[model samples]
Target: MRITEVEIHEFDYEVARTGTVGGNWVYDPDSTLEPPGFVLTIRTADGTEGHYRGFAFTPPMIAQVTMVAEEHLLGRDPLERRGIWQDCWRALRHTDHFGLGAIDVALWDLAGRHYGESVSGLLGGYRDTLPTYASTMFVDDSGGLDGPDAFADYAETCLDRGYDGFKFHGHPDVRPDVDIAICEALAERVGDEMALMIDSSSLYRTYADALRVGRALDDLEFFWYEDPMHDGGVSERTTKQLATTLDTPMLGLEHVRTGPYGTVDSLAGESTDLVRASAHMDGGITGALKTADAAEAFGTDVELLLGGPAHMHLMSALRNSSFFEHGLLNPESTWILNQGFEGEPESIDDDGRMAVPDGAGLGVEIDWAFVERRRTGHTLID
Candidate 1:
């Protein structure tokens, strides 16, 4: 079927907080926060519509979506996913092409609906459930995860909840010694019962700092060391050096572009022991699958970043990958975004495994009323 129209809806959602300690999208220390979310609907002439939601949209990202919808996606066949993906890739080659991913994802959702299947099934379903880890929020000084003992206590709570693994989103102060102390404390608390990992979020300022922290992780027998030093995990030589220096596997390239091509280059350079794939960041499902397959070819696992319906599908299908990240989680905040769902809002089972939605497409049924109430603006291209 051919596409007849595209609609973009921008909305605001209240978040407990609006900044990340490090990695991509780190907010300024004093920046005023007005977080934005968007939903794009591609409606076909025959009345088949594909819907996709994107969180944390910048002004440029919103503009890119509008441009792509008006110029490239208005009348194309929704079934021509690969061709559409390639066209969008070329259309915005000069830029990182952030908005292309949302459109590509919506197209995949449409494809799944048209075929009466789930996206995971379309991508070759491997499993129905995935073990998940408790990925914590950045350490705060506000009496919530403020210190090492607090983190260890939280780890114990997660273990009691049935999580097989836990990951710390360390403090943003770039203190390697503090990070090491936290790691050691966590190991002492629940290392025997849970596999632990850490995402420094690129906080460490120097190779020496990262090396020192890496050695501590090696001693604690942590699962992986992620985005350890600065340079935003983009320096192949430096990452390679870190990987060679540490026994703990380095998971890098979470912020790189070009999906599989960039991942393959890093692999060839021996920069990372493992690769990272995110459907949202890596050109939607198409690019993420390419990265996963490339990682497979190299005899390594691809840890898909973030948590969502799309990530659950990828994790279910990929054999090399392990543990879904139930992230940015904290005691005071709720991760639930959508309301009026039948099962648990977060998609996590009582056994600590993430369950794939069995419904068609992404398998998520949105509460349109809730979304409409939150709408700040809308744009329609016909």
Candidate 2:
């Protein structure tokens, strides 16, 4: 079967539990948000179609699908994704190729459906369940995850609920003093029973602040320190220095848009102790798989950022990866990840582990009725 058409649907969705907090998604009741959601469909001439529900971005991905890839994908073999991925990768060069994942993932879905296997199985997966960590939103003042005591109390609550690890986004403004205090308090409370981490989100104003917090984390024995520098993790000199200075492993490159190619720099520079890959941010599952393989070759661990079924499928086959980010959660609120389908925390059981979907492809069914009711824009390319 040959490629015939591609379609993109933009829709509206809102949730009380999940909203932007200092660049990280969090469960917050004080914030009411209507973030746009996207879904892409690619159909062959014979009527088989594959789908991808987008997370993390809306417009660039939409533009990449509707504008850049409109005429480029017609009449090609739908299952031969490598060359198609390369074409879009070059086409989107000016914009970091942000929306290639939408195309690449849909093709993977098509392949899985054709082969009668899950996406993980297509990648030769072995494990069925993934251990989880409660990744938190940025520090807040509106009565949730606000201060040291609030964070400590929440960490203990997660531990009681069977979580294996906990991670929190520091203040969006990057307060080293306040961040250190929360780390110390959490260490006193449940650091030994559960692994701990802090994501600075690249908000630190000065290298000194990152150093101070990194020194504190070294003492607390946190699992990892993520994106601590204000330089946006592009400064190889600073990242390498920080990695050597701190005993806590540094997880960097969340902002890097070069796919797996640039990751080779971080590995050679010895800047990052752990690698960051995302199906959304990193080209697609195909690119993320390359990233994971590159990390494994260097004997480093790779972590998938955010939570979603695409990420779950990729991580299931990775031997060097750890933890499904079951996050941006608020214990007192509903965890609405996306509007069209079920996300993590809901799939996570009492044991704090999530099983890979045994069905073919991404193993997700979209709520088309919900999409129709909230439809915003639709594009068709044939």
Candidate 3:
């Protein structure tokens, strides 16, 4: 069936138990925020529709989505994802392809529904449950991810709760010393028990700082060091030097949003040990799979970055992926973007593996009531 119409439903959601500190989402236990949320939906003439809400949404992205959907999506074949992706890429050539993923994801969800299959199944999935890492929030002074002991204590709790891997997001603004302390603590506390990693979030303003933290991670035998420098993860030269010098594997390119094409430049430079892709930023599942194929051809692993229900499906179909990135999670709350889903966004079993949603399409139900109840505004293309 042909695609008939596209829509963006915007709503307002409260961010509970989360707030920013030091330019990072910190443990503000009493924090509550009302932020606008957007969901992209694509419909076919057959009354089949697919929905998406998992990406890191912003106003500029919403603008781009509007442009791409209006310019390329209406009246196209929903199943002709590759063509749409390419055309949208050309459309967003001036931007970072920000809106392509949301559109493509909705289209994939639509296709999966039309065919009576899950997105993972649509992607030729082999695994049903994927292992996960407890990706922590940036170091906060608010006692949530505050210090070495606090971090170590949290690691112990996460391990007890069945996470087999842990990733640290140190000071949003970068404090190498503090970060080193916490990484070392987690290593000593439970590194032998679970894989450990650190994502500096491109906050290390100086090469020396990134080097220092990388060295500490090496000593701890950590699993990976992610986006260590303030280069927005695009500089091949800087990353090549760090990857060569560090014993710890480097994971980079999350901030680089050129879809699968960016993976080629980074891989060719041998700039990172692990590549990063997301259905959110990488032109949706189509782009992410292209990235995974590119990384596989180069004999490297592609780690799916950030939160989404779409991620489980993507990861399940991936053989070269490491772990399902569960959270920038704290003790008190889960993902704010999971508001209108059937269950929470990421469902972890007792074995620390995330379950692929078992139904058709993206395999998750949307709480349309919630969307309609808190409706803010919408854009529709017919």
Candidate 4:
């Protein structure tokens, strides 16, 4: 069946609090706060529709999705995902590929619905459940996760909750000594029972600083050290040096622009011990899978970067990847994104594992009533 219509819905959902590190958004210091959400709906001639929700949506991104859907997607078979993705990629070559990713995932959702199987099954399911780690939000002045002792206490809480792993997103202004203290505290607290990791988020200003932190992690036998320095995770030379200097394996390339090619190049350069792939950032599931295959070929593991159904599907299919990241978590507030989904698959169970929904498509049930209540604007392509 051919796609007959495409609808873009924009809405706002309140977040409990804003997370800041060094006077900026913790994720991207330069970027503005993102709009709540953008939901894309692709309709077929037979009345079946595919839906996908995107994070950090902006006006330009919504416009790009609209243009791509109207220009290259409408009237094409939804099942021709690869062709559509390629065409959209070429059309938007001068722009960010997030729009292409949004449409591509929607198409996959449609295909899953058509086949009456979950997206993971469509991608060749390997397992129904995945071990998950609680990825914490950046440190704040608030008493919640402010210091090393606080962080250790939080790790104990997570361990009690059945998490097998805990990853800390430290404050941006934190120094090497403080970083080392946090690492040591965590290792002393729960390191034996749980796999511990640290994501500097590229806050360290020098190789020496990163090396210091890396050496501490090595002493503690941490799982991985990520985005260690201010090079923003792009410099193959710096990453290679850091990997060589430290015993802890480096996980890099989360911010790299090119999809599978970038991952393969970093692997070939021996810059990273483990690679990172996000369905949202890596050109959707297609790009993520390509990177995964590349990592598999090199005998390296590709860690899925974020939590979501799409991410869950990719992690479930790939054997090399280890744990699902339940991220930006905070003690003061919940991590709920929207009230639209009937089931929240991202929530970790008592075993610290997340299960993939077995229903058709992404297996997510959207609450249209909630969407309509929250919607601020809409666009339709026919």
Candidate 5:
């Protein structure tokens, strides 16, 4: 089917209470500005349409992307999805193409709809139900020290609901001490009954700091350490520290871009464990698949991060794919209003597993009413 129209939807929700911290490494908010959420809609000539969502962006950015892509996509074949992904990415390299991940997701969904197949099948189907883990970010007003208690509460809730594993945001300012405490408490609370992971979000500030945190988590038998340091320069250093200093595996590459592969090669030099591939951020299915292959050459395993349901489809099918990052707080209320599966922790299986959408093309249905209700200004393109 050919693309008849493309529409971009931007929405906002009143910030009720900001309990969780920002995913960005450097975060300092005086409690004034609210975060934005963006979602996109693409319609094909045959009357089939697809929807995809993303977090932490402004309406102007979403509008800017829609303006650039509407011209490129409108008379093209919706089935030619990979080509659509490449062209859009190549054209937007000079202007923060990372923000364009939502478009890549929309294109994949479009192709799935046109071919009447699940996105997972296209990604090379492996299993229907992929085990998932809870990643928690709840913190009390005390800043960071309250994390351990909040984590304990959250973990227990997930466990009660049937989840097998859970992860917590481990960082310094958020309570470096609390990070240690939570890992220790979690190990004690669940023991081998659940798998545990810690995401530092590169909050350690220095490589040495990351090393200390990694060692602590390793002692606690934590699964992996995420983004201990954001800079590529220290990636190998940090990975080596984790491998040697601590047995904890380093998991990241979520915000990584496609490039010379030098950093990835260095990290895999008996230092790193898994390269976290975010299909949304790293281009799309085609680009992500390429990244996965490159990691294989270096003997680094690919652990895909499912930012949401759309990515979950691909992660379920990926052979080398590991687990997904499930957001605890609704960064963007409108982003998931219409998609299947409520944001409730229970949507994930008791064993922390997810079943691939069995129906055609991502197996997700859009709730236009929800979309229209949240629409800020632009109309849903027919």
Candidate 6:
């Protein structure tokens, strides 16, 4: 189907809980909790739509994305996902790649709608159920919880809930040694029961600092590290340094956008063990799929991160997939708002795994009225 129109929506969602890591602090010292997230939605000409939930983006970022989409994707085939993505990248490279992802996701959502297939089907098909890991974000203002206790409690909860593994996002301002000690306790408490990982979230300011932490975690035998540093801004020399010094894999670059025609290397080279590919944030289905392959070429795996039905839909389809990143975000809005799987996946599984929705494309078709009811502003090209 030829594309007729593209629509984007920026809406506000509630935040029931807030999380803190040692390196990055989202918890306002003066506040009670973290702020709600910003979500985006895309609609195509044929009337099909897709959903994207992420951090509240700035006006300039949103505008930059819309401008690129308008210039390059007004009347293209919704199914020629890749070609259309290339057009956006080439057209918008002048603006420093501006949210190249938002536009790509719009197109992919359009394609899934057109094919009447789940976003996962568009990628290589995989097991219906995959393992899920719990990512806890806690802002411990009360100080009642320590790193080890926090990790143990969360990991045990994941085990009780049937999840296969668990990850803890450390308090941004907390000491690295404190965070490491927490990981140590978590490893000891549930090592045999489940896999464990830690998110430094750019806690280490220098490559050596990161290396020291990575080596410590390696001794702990954790799965892999998450976002030890930021994207291209993180020095390649540093990446090489960390890579050589640490046995554990480094994971990140979640902020890169999907290409109308660009590759992962075009954005960031293979410096990590795992790259986060959000179908919604990475240009929807089309751009995400290609990037998954590129990640594999660089010997990196794809961690399908973030919220929404679209994420589960994409995870179900990826061949070289990692775990479904399950976090309890605004459950009051998302789960209460969603007509799909009620509340999160049933549990991890008997095999210590979790699966995707068994239904058709995207599995869950969200109610647009619910979205429109909460609509804050337009993100699409009219």
Residue-wise C-alpha lDDT for candidate 4, range 62-122, written one tens digit per residue:
7778777777988899999988878987787777676776787788888999999889999
* Over 4 Å off, model 3: none
The positional error of residue 76 in candidate 3, measured at the CA in angstroms, is 0.8
Stretch of 10 with least lDDT, candidate 2: 337-346
lDDT of each: 0.80, 0.84, 0.85, 0.82, 0.62, 0.59
By descending TM-score, how would the candidates be arranged?
A: 3, 2, 4, 1, 5, 6
Instruction: Please identify which of the two predictions, 2 or 3, would achieve the higher TM-score against the true structure.
Output: 3
Q: How far is candidate 1 from the true structure (C-alpha RMSD, Å)?
A: 2.7
The list of candidate 5 runs beyond 4 A from truth reads: 14-16, 20-34, 58-64, 142-145, 171-174, 230-244, 259-271, 329-346, 379-382
Clashes of each: 0, 0, 1, 0, 6, 30
Which runs of model 4 end up more than 4 angstroms from their true locations? 22-35, 57-60
Tens-digit per-residue lDDT, 28-135, candidate 5: 233323355556777876678776765544554575466566566778877776677678777777665564566677777877777788888777777877767766
Candidate 2 error regions (>4 Å): 17-28, 342-346
lDDT of 3 at 35: 70
Candidate 1 lowest-lDDT run of ten: 23-32
Per-residue error for 262 in candidate 5, Å, reads 6.6
**Structural RMSD, model 2:** 1.7
Per-residue lDDT over 104-161 for candidate 6, one digit per residue giving the tens place of the 0 to 100 score: 5555555566677655676656667777877655324444234577568757866887
Report residue 10 deviation for candidate 2 (angstroms).
0.5
**C-alpha-based local distance difference test score of model 2:** 0.84
